[model samples]
Target chain A: MSSRLSLRGFLALSALRTVNSLSRGTGRGSGTVAGGRVGLAIYPKLLNDLSKNRQVILVSGTNGKTTTTALCVAGWGDKVCSNATGANMPAGHVAALSGSSSPHVVLETDEAWLPVALEATNPRVVVLLNLSRDQLDRATEVRSIAERWRSALSKTAHDLVVVANANDPLVVYASESAKNIRWCNIETPWTSDAVSCPKCTQSIVRTSGSWSCVCGFTKPGCVASVSGSEVRIDNETVQTSLSIPGQFNVGNAAMAATALDVLNVDPSKSLTSMKSVTAIAGRFAVRTWQGRKIHMLLAKNPAGFDALLQSLSPGTDDVWIAINARIADGKDPSWLYDVSFEQLRGRKVWCLGERRLDLSTRLDYANVTYEVVNDLNSLPKTSDTTELLANYTAFSDWMQRTTA
Target chain B: MKIALIYPELLGTYGDYGNALALSQRSTRRGIDVDVMNVSITDELPDADLYLLGGGEDGPQRLAADLLKKSSLKQRVANGAHVFAVCAGLQILGTSFCVEGNDAYEGLSLVDVETTRGSVRSVGELLSQVGENKMVGFENHGGVTTLSPGIEPLGTVLHGRGNNGHFDGFVTETIWATYAHGPVLAMNPWLCDEVIAKVTGNNLTPLKTAADQLYAERVTSLSSR
Candidate 1:
């Protein structure tokens, strides 16, 4: 271990391990970050060895990376160790690497820290989730960050195998120098955004739920496509066909399948592992509260919010939009104006949080009916059956309240 | 009365589509039919009176540039279709966008000058002075945009970013592009009406509705954070 690793490190490590063990004490091994004593010193060497042997995969994006990383790790099984705790930054990544004893790691990385992480812990396989504008306060422009990744990968990668969203031409375009590239796509109808032809500047058109460019070029279909027919997601993990809803989830699945395949995992084995895939807590998870099932979907950005809205059953369900002013929540709530609140239709919307008034104003402007609540102290008593859409912090509080 | 919404994917960061939704609903109240045609990499770009592209991550900009290069979308832009490009859209529409030390990505010359993707990204509520009018919106972009000659600048820098001064959006006769993300159009109907008029060339008046009045009251009562 480096100078950073001392008795202090050991104590912290032991504490986390104890917590992990306690969390799993109830049985069912609720899946925590693996490896308890690798230490931060050995991480650089691990990265070096992995790079030399061509055995690392870095997946990063604004949303979906956590679930995608978990799926890839599950697909790799014991072969891959990862930062599964959704710790995506540099220090967190260090903790993840120290906690992993595997030869290869299929890690989920954040955009801002990917460059630094790659330099320190060079990964052979870099899986880039589609980039979306997020947390401009801490994150560089998406393109600038993408260019950094492109440059770093081109320099550090040996036999790079890149898996990208063909629908998101940005990812396709960014992995320009990958020695090998395999494409995955979220079947159309599940996607609201597609790239314009990079060559012609014309908006690429979609036909029958598949994407096609007008210049006589069609992106090769996904090796493993996640279509509505193929996917089976329900209220219960055992009851539902798949784990998560929304087409973006399908894309994440496709990305995971492609990355694991690059690692030489059998398609069928990977598919079977996906059977265990459950929605990450804040991403899209369901909790039964007093006999009523409540589904929580994190709506951080417009695309995420839009996807979450699209995946939800639009009806008379009580909804909540919790707005926070954290740098991560986005400084400005103006983008709420572009969101299609029409999806809510007759659904009740409760705009709550610090930005509640801002959201309420936009809702009013769109003529979308919503009630504003600044604090939960005065929350009206409702039936257990009420469905709620909430902001991230508000949702967290609401989840704690209801779950407890 | 069918309206087409173009390049939504590229410009969808910070809820750019919400602007389109606002436009669609506003038009719907006016009894106009709307079809939001999403032009992706698979199909040819459709011709629409109005075209909107919002801010997004870098990959979208490069891909959008490449796709726009292949399609005759630039020719259409030169032919004078009303275009509303914001943030990343505005950056990608330039002659080229520089990713700091990285190679510059070529852009459609719909607007002159270029953009330098900065290490430090700017994010905050932006208020710019347009003549005597104040344009308020959220500003978030990691690149600096310089306006070339012949392009009409939108407004003077008031708060967040000034044109070419870390926070000004480039403006042309029929095209309005900016880094300001907010219900930019929602707050400023003047710009929305201007785009609508340019696209349709018909001076249609915006009518007052219950939603509109309610929105006005809410705006009047909004407490800034």
Candidate 2:
């Protein structure tokens, strides 16, 4: 395919590169947003033109987009481009595709922006992950987003493949009208967002491993699934020995492996490549704090938090929960109630962050004892390893402080 | 004292359920014993000294209002049980409120008030003053409530939009309803103590601790911003 760009597209690409370099030269953080904005402002259809001839794969959902995108990039092997950072907006897409000459591109996308990005990329495969309430102060309701996805995917061409999570009712409902779909049975621990069927508003009946509603909406038969650390696709089973420590990551790997199968890639090679990815962006990074090895985990919503809590070892007790209510963290911390913190009934919890008081209050209701530490330096010294779970901005601050 | 948390599965969207936790913690801190009852929809409403309700989405809010209307919840409130309701809970306790387009549901009428959809949804940090006590919390709701004649306002809105853009909440002899839900009682310990005092019919001594300092800092930081 010829990589020819129109005059306006070429100008936008050139402007993006120049601004990116200038932004990095000054230390104004990553130039992804700034450059992408300039490029799109100049040429409105820059993303469409850049991705017209390339085979694009779009990964999107409420959570795990960054990690799943990284896995997909690893599965595609060499000569593939992707947005490795957490930037998933249109500007970020333009920035990632502007300088690459690769024919294959894997991109992470925001849930609300999936429809717009699908139109721009016209992707060969779209991975639909679980949907849940996230940043409700800034985001629309979960059902509204699902409705938008259903409409957008229904209008796509017949050959376009959709990889959806079968266990999540919302995902099944959203991709039901797709021409071709590969269902993956990824077990979801959070079901509050999908208690009512998206199709008929009836209560969903859930068993140990599956869910169905009286309205005829139910979990689809899976073409791909993950059991323990193994991913089963068709007649073959690939062992996923990933350094990332969570069943959720195993489920993500299964989704990536299935998407690779649609692209005619070897599942064994994809699993091998995925094992090399220990951390996506900065999530699941281990850091030493106060003479203890602390595993840092990021959970922006109740569903993500529930997954993290379920993945913890039975013996793991010492925990530090950090919360912040900044602009990027959605300002309203009312979602804390939705999270089941009762699991930490007998654990020692140290509440840290701008909203530590709010968390302390939550822990009090959970019948859990906790200590409020305003300053990180004053955090008590623990000999055993501890786990740190933080929301968006708090996670970023801790990563910057410990890594710097 | 026994505190019943009403329909948590349906009406526990925001951290409004934290109010129950706040009451338990504050009561324990004051040497007052309290038992918390988690009540679901299918279960019968248990009689208690106090009832706690939280906020939720429109569908669940309507379901809760319908369920509570059929039960004897109004008699419990009328018998002088201390009740605290937040956002959707406040709306469900009023005489009537709009749930969605062109549809309204009748509330338990525990308080003499009515609710309608606000012109714009209000979401932000809320600061108010109830008598000599300063109340701080977060408010996110679309219901605009109007109090009946001779009804008392919960507090005056000092910052951000409160109940109808002016008043923060409503209060009767034994019930309190408000849109401010940082689990209102958690951020405003004084209000929690006041509610407890009303239940036990005794003036409880206040204990100064780190929560007060955190509350003060939050109020300062949010107000200045």
Candidate 3:
């Protein structure tokens, strides 16, 4: 073993304690990066040490990671510890494991961090959710992320069971290296990123719901599948009464159940536990402002936006759409065109956020009439329910404002 | 007016297909009959006045370049059809470009330029001067292009890297290419007008909408800071 691996002792553990105390002394909040940064600086393999005896469940994807991680933790009630704050990096993983002594752990891992997180955690069940073009400026490309996942899965296939979405070709290509994978057919409407087969470079031919490539990379048999709201597993349908809105959440719940099933957790009980989670990290959360209870839904990328756009009832009150190209969101707001903003036609759309003009331009092209809203105070004070869809930074800004 | 949205499935990364929507609507607003043909990867390129190719990932980009090299996009452009492309679209219209670490693929060769991978990915709000008209759009590309002699650039870079640090894109009477992809035409209505007017052979009245105001606002905001 390497000298670093051999150096495990009270010194490493005490180092974390000292750093945590020192960080607390600095008067920073318990939630920031200081503690985790210090712990990893000393331990190096901090997550590996913390996750030694735990049954770790690492959920990573372009979308649905936070929600799925939340669902899995909710499934176990106080049994599973997780980074529920949407912090999906190494620091977040270290912090989550250090905070709770629960034998079970769930981590919401970023898509790019999957290989590193997988190596560190030695997870029991690794959930590979759908992949799509999200934050392309920073994430680079979805195919590159998939290739990384594939390479990592090839090495660690024997140690873990991968629960992946079969509906997404990119997800399938990434998880094909796994020795054991519970494939789930959770439908995602965005198919722009997966036209070219990830493996053979041949075009993916999707007839009905099934898909296949000429090089024989076809859709695998799904262990569990969600058709609209109904989830089917082992030829039996599970009536999932989710408090969360959108069919995507139903898919998330089904995916969580499938992942939990690997741990011998009752899928039905897991779904029941998931029913209590009305919102995930303020996603789909209703925040009252100016007498309007704005049902805020996060729709940052094209895939996320496509799912949210499906919920827009035709000819409803003015739908509020906000976009920001902050670093957290991709610096390039080009993906706005990939979304069907044309669906917002015949409805008065109120544009908000920093990229409000860019979005207005996009709407103008889609032939969707819109009004640029620079401030929340300018919102109409009608008591009618108003739905607001926003990208990552814009949504986070909204959360910050309301919470503050 | 027919607008061919070329290979959106293969080359539509960064919302590249939005260019077609922008072009079509901008023409329709001016009382022109517009038919936008959503051409997928497997579909044939329809006869159109203007064709748009957007940015794409490496594999799809290479595939799109290969497909277009063999397809009628070259012959169509030769026959007075206009082509507007971005990033990967810009690269694919050139003589050759590199992808997947130095593996060079032959391009459509419609434009006299070549692109090679660079260390720094040029990604930000790019401001440029396109013949007195200031163009504001987001540029996210890694390819540094070298233009052939006498090849005209779309604009001189005022802020971000276009073809390189100094200039933005290649421009001809029949072809317009750039790395700027807030769907180029949507961000710069004047460029769209130039393409539309060139094809229609008629002067267009300056139809101002929220898009134009947004363009003016973007140019002001992107320029001031």
Give the per-residue Cα lDDT of candidate 3 at A265: 81
Q: How well does candidate 3 score on lDDT at residue B175?
A: 88
- Model 1 iRMSD vs. native: 4.5
Question: What is the CAPRI rating of model 3's predicted complex?
Answer: medium
State how far residue A10 of model 3 sits from its true place (Å): 4.2
Clashing pairs in 2: none
Question: Which lDDT value does model 1 have at B158?
Answer: 59
Off by over 4 Å in 3: A1-12, A18-32, A313-315
Q: What local lDDT does model 3 show for residue B128?
A: 93
Separate DockQ for every predicted complex: 0.32, 0.41, 0.73
- Residue B35 miss distance in model 2 (angstroms): 4.8
Q: On residues B1-225, what C-alpha lDDT tens digit does candidate 1 reach at each position?
A: 334454566656566765676567666666666666776555688877677777765666677677777887778777876677777777777888864355788988777868876656666766676665556667777777777767767776656654456447777776788776645666555556566666766767666533343344433433242
In the range A338-368, model 2's lDDT, one tens digit per residue, is 7889988878889988889878867766777
TM-score of chain B of each: 0.84, 0.95, 0.96
Candidate 3 structure quality by residue, lDDT tens digits, A1-404: 02223355235555655666666443332333456767677778877877887899999888888888888998877767788777789887877776667789899998888999999989999998899998877776888888999999999856599999999999999999888888998877888889889986668999888999889989999889997778886666778888888888899889898988888888878888898887888887888765568888898788888888886666657888889888888888888888888777888889999889888888877778788887667778878778889888889888876641
For model 3, what TM-score does chain A reach? 0.94
Q: State each candidate's chain A TM-score.
A: 0.77, 0.96, 0.94
lDDT of 2 by residue, B1-225 (tens): 899998776677676666887788778887889899998776789999998888877777888888889887888877778788888988898899987664667887877888888888898888887888778888888878899998898989888888877898888888887888636787777788888889888788877644576578778876686
Highest TM-score scorer: 3
